[model samples]
Target: MGTTTSGCCFPLRGSQAPTGPEVQLCENCKRLVLTEKEVIHMARTGMWEIEGYEMTDSSPDFPKLKESAENGCDFCLFLRNTLLSPEVDFDADEIPRIRKTYRDAGHQLLFHRAGYRMSIYDEGKLWLSFEIWIVHDATGDMELLPSLSLQDPPKPRVAPSQNALQSTTNLFLRQAIERCDAYHDKCKVGRDPAFLPTRLVDVRDENAVRLVEGFTIVGGDDASSSSAPKYAALSYCWGPRAHADQQLKTTDENIGQHLFEIPMKGMPAVLKDAIRATRELGIPFIWIDCLCIIQGNLQDWEKEAGSMHKVYGSAYITLCPTMSKSCLNGFLFRDPPSIVFPYHSLNGQPAGMYRIRFTRSWIWKMYLTVPHHPFAVDLISGSWVRRGWTFQEAALSSRMVLFGASATHFHCRTSRVTEGEDTETSVSLDDLGLFPLLPSTLSGDKLDEAWKHIVASYSQRNFTKHTDAIAALAGLAHRFHSLREKDEYCSGMWLSQLHEQLLWRRAMYEGISWGWFFNLLDPELPERVLLHAPSWSWIQRINIDYQYIRDSVLPTEPEDDGSDGHGDMSITPSPGLTDETLRLEWRLPGKSGDESSVVDRFMQFRGQELEITGFVARFPLANADKPLEVDELREADTNLFWKWTISGQYFCHTNWDFLSYTSWDRIDKGEFQHLRMLLLSSGRGKSSGEVSPGNAASSDGNISENGDVEEDDRTAFGLFLFPTIKESENGKFYRVGTWHSFCNGKGGFVRFLQYATVESLVLV
Candidate 1:
């Protein structure tokens, strides 16, 4: 915000690079004091406050302003950002001159990449024509010299390679610590519920980085331990079980022995990359699950797992290998990947002017502060995005540097930028930029919606061990609790809408799918979902409908909100009852029930069951996306039977409800098939005059005045029940698709206010 006291020209006309001491002399007092990097960066970002200096706006010409500024002032950077090809054709040797001028002054120019780097781009319309770096001296100040191109510039001698990329990565890591992180200002410094000591790999000095003998957490609260060292954490996919002899894991036997002796040769590529990054970023310590926590000891694993919240939240930064599908894939590429587009000015100068376009998504177009660029979004939606364990890792950490497919992205609670993007574009997270992540500070997020956002994204992810479903979300759940009311966490559902959550069926339930279903209908898939949670918990299912889980009770749309980029996943539930909960006991499908108990599997409700006498209808499996109306279903008066093919001798015929079997027939007597059914209230919520069936439709007004229901609550939610795998296990019932569903207006069902007097039920 400072101005020139002597009214000197920018891009100084003389033969020397402009020095801060000469150009920024006090206008009123005639002092030679200058600003530092921190001050310039702030001014460049429009902060406007430079200590001891007057803050004033400057109205400088684009060409002249670019000529000065040894380290490239914020104003010059902005002009470059929105600069297009000019009409005048001149200055064939401008880049060489600018470089020489700054080289003499001991300052070098740098690009957005790690170190002081430069890129020379060329296309017919806009040459982006040239980029330059000037250095006052090797150890002196360095920055990007003002680049000028009115016509096509000569090609540079250097090409992008490993060294350049390394420079870029190094610069990004440095800026993250020095500029992004607020450090102690906003981080949760309070001790968590448990004092579980942590083992951290001290990587500040890579050569002296002792492992088995790493640092350990100590002392009580910060009040007593004010000088505790800061650290970083890593979130990544462990991949499939590697060869035991090759992988380095902490076992109960080696708990105190060979940990430090673990060689870097045996370390997985993922861990090696993370360690190197930590060291380069200057973090004192790091924590990884398998090495830091004893892998073979149940007691140690349980304690460490419980304290995941504090471990991540307290870290100075978190490194995310967002593009790596597995540890074997590794991270840190040799060159930054990017797609370039060429553009000609629309100012009627097709051949007269051209520009290079590096964006596919505009931040302002999204009508949001956090916008998604198509390139970034595409890179983000990779196999790594589906890992069940990493969901909470990204959410809990205050700051993160996501190393993606081609380039890396940086994000914090207050700001975001990328290695491939201009860092000076925005000063606040609320402004426009090239970030592909959500704001860390979710100012207006709702509790139910937040959980829905988490579930929707988490359900779509892949898990090595299905048992880790809830475990993976432990940190997210811990943080979510702080934002919402003290609602009990049901195995997976919340106690607030326990009834509606119970009605959750897989997106591909009962051979019905809205989009493409990835897995087969058979339950015996390669990735066996070990039954650790109750059958009611989604933790027990696979290929779950990620979208449905976000708003299980609402008619929702496709949204990528939450940490995984899923969006608008909040459910606004209707006020209803929650004084009762269905209690149950369960066992694995193969271990429960006996041959004589096969009938018990067909019917397994334990409490008083009351029927609501509702209408029955069959789902049009082909048109599952569209709810089948009562009129359309009743028109198909044929009796549908669900047959048990695995047993080859049994089938049951029911009117609509998968329950209440009417006829017992062998597979040969009926069409062997998978069927979806629904038992809906026949306008019965109006029996007490709360809402008349005819009046309800008329008031909503989707139907004609003559009383024809055109749009039934097909997309609405309702109570759904399906028999467990035991229905096929005992050899007398049907077990087709591992997933199930029900269709009834029970639309937007907040809770099961009209449940049959049925309570206790076992999945087996």
Candidate 2:
């Protein structure tokens, strides 16, 4: 997604082909970019065409580009190259693998000089993959280099001796496990060594892998004061399966037979590789969720699932089968093209292929394995990162061993080392920015920021089970207990951060009907999701776009609800606030509370009489040209309301329809239920003429903790009025939109403002 700048956004791609070392540039355009500000300017103002309004060949710049194409410009030729152009910078051995990839997709892969980019072309669909690396040439001119991506798949390097227990990868695993042990005993860090998990699959030995008979929990500290088994956990995607796809499950009957029925060879590829790796690492046990948790038994699944945080966090190490799409897709693969490259000095002199240290990280030490940098490319780019379960697994574990298609990786607290790479390229762990799940030593206010970070990341990821929204983060949420007292977990929103947390929304996109997903209007996606949660909770509106919302500030802890578990769901105005900004004493319905009563398909603000206060006028929704029809918003000037609302898991609308933009952060607090959410616009006062918000033809809809909305001398704050529920009897309201006007509405709005009394209303 392209980023918004100032009040607008530019096109993500350029009108003409991009220029630089990595980017193809014709002789005429080579020195052209270094002198002009086109690139930087385009980045700010965006391309002449936005999403809804596209620029065509008639666009002034398009003629020049087309002429250049006809004139055979080098950059133009590169862009127009529809036929296969023989290209290569790789060693001879990689050709077969590259050809195989092309054959699999019926496409061709092309690599330009210095291996800057990989262009895949088949039919009319073309994708150019390149990571731009900038450099300073001898003339002091900046140059760019595109890094190519045909690295060989990682294969375990086994030791020469048949008696050797450790393969090259297993050696690093042993060191990571032992290093954690050393930290427990010697380091000043006050982490507990007794934090071992409650359950483990005790791989009998290097010769055998199976769970102990009738062994669910390894009876240790809870059963005795003695030590427990050190185990490794496997993290991989289950992937899309057949309609009736059924993996092995543990049930009451099968639980007793697992030891007898489950065998190493019978396991899936990923699990088998995990067992082999665990045995080779000299760890006596390993834990896999699917194999250990009884699938059909809800009670057993919940009990084991809820403890996943501790199981993963306390594990000796987490093995990431990064290359696999499913358990069926194993970690090990046939070695492809080599990662090592022939070295070239500053003077362009030929040097030997660059060497990489496999033994240092492979040999492990007492200090932490810090990440030197984020990986330029992550493993597989598959369903792994997309899975909601994987985030917690990756965050909770202090150590991980990633078996990727390109290379292996070792991650711990201090460092992240890639297989077959030198230290200079290693990523530092701090750059990963894992919140609340950060090191235990990192406590205090930063934890809140970390928690939000985790929430935002978790919100964007997907879950196979829409009901597992909270369950997926149950591990991290359980750990956040000390951050606040009990009753903090309200479905998905926190009681402490209730006010701001309610601001979450579904991600907005382009082309889809925005009206289909809202709580009111022609609610398209509303009927699709499960109703395990109240309408107000983010869990009910799963697959949110929380990351785009600005949450990068400390949270102001509101007064705790202080109610016991299963409290009442109601609302009241927060007291003692002098400013127009108001806080609400809104209580989310408890788990047992009747959501149908608290929230219906349509609900209303019940009070004596209502008058306009103020409505939010956000900045432009990502350079959208959608006309804003509402006006008279409080202090309206450059503020632009979101022009569209779309549906996914929640009511959503994006600026450029993809790249995220800031959304309004006001406390509607169930105020807009029943799809009565309004955007009141009146241009009664403003220097920039009468500026309205979104057009009445449509409807769409946060301050950071440290952020504040300052009152300016622009105009009287306008009241953006929206209808809550369209008064449906069944209590269901299809979300359509709101009404907007540059001038205050003559009839209802003016009469209400003049004759209406300030009446407090409770939405539910």
Q: Which candidate leads in TM-score?
A: 2
Clashes of each: 41, 55
Per-prediction RMSD in angstroms? 18.7, 15.8
lDDT for model 2: 0.40
The Cα error of candidate 2 at residue 331, in Å, is 1.2
Show where candidate 1 strays beyond 4 Å.
Answer: 1-174, 177-197, 212-227, 242-245, 257-261, 335-375, 378-382, 420-445, 482-485, 509-532, 543-716, 722-764
Instruction: Score each candidate by Cα lDDT.
Output: 0.40, 0.40
**Candidate 2 structure, TM-score to reference:** 0.54
Model 1 C-alpha lDDT per residue in residues 1-764, reported as the tens digit of each score:
34432223222222333221212212321111112332233324522222222221121233433543335453333334432222010111112343343323333332221111122222221112122222233333323322222222222212223331276667866776567534423433332323333677656555655443323444322435644566678888765455223556777776565345555776777778888888777666778776788887887776677667778777777888765555654577532222121112223222111122121111111221222332244233334455667777766776677776435767666555656445422222222122212234443433444444455456756666655777777656656555554554555556554444544444322322211121222245444433434434565455333232222122233232233221232333322222233342223233444622312221122211222222222323332231212221111221222221112211111122222123323122222222323222211121112223422221333222343222432222333333333345331112122221111222221212222233333221
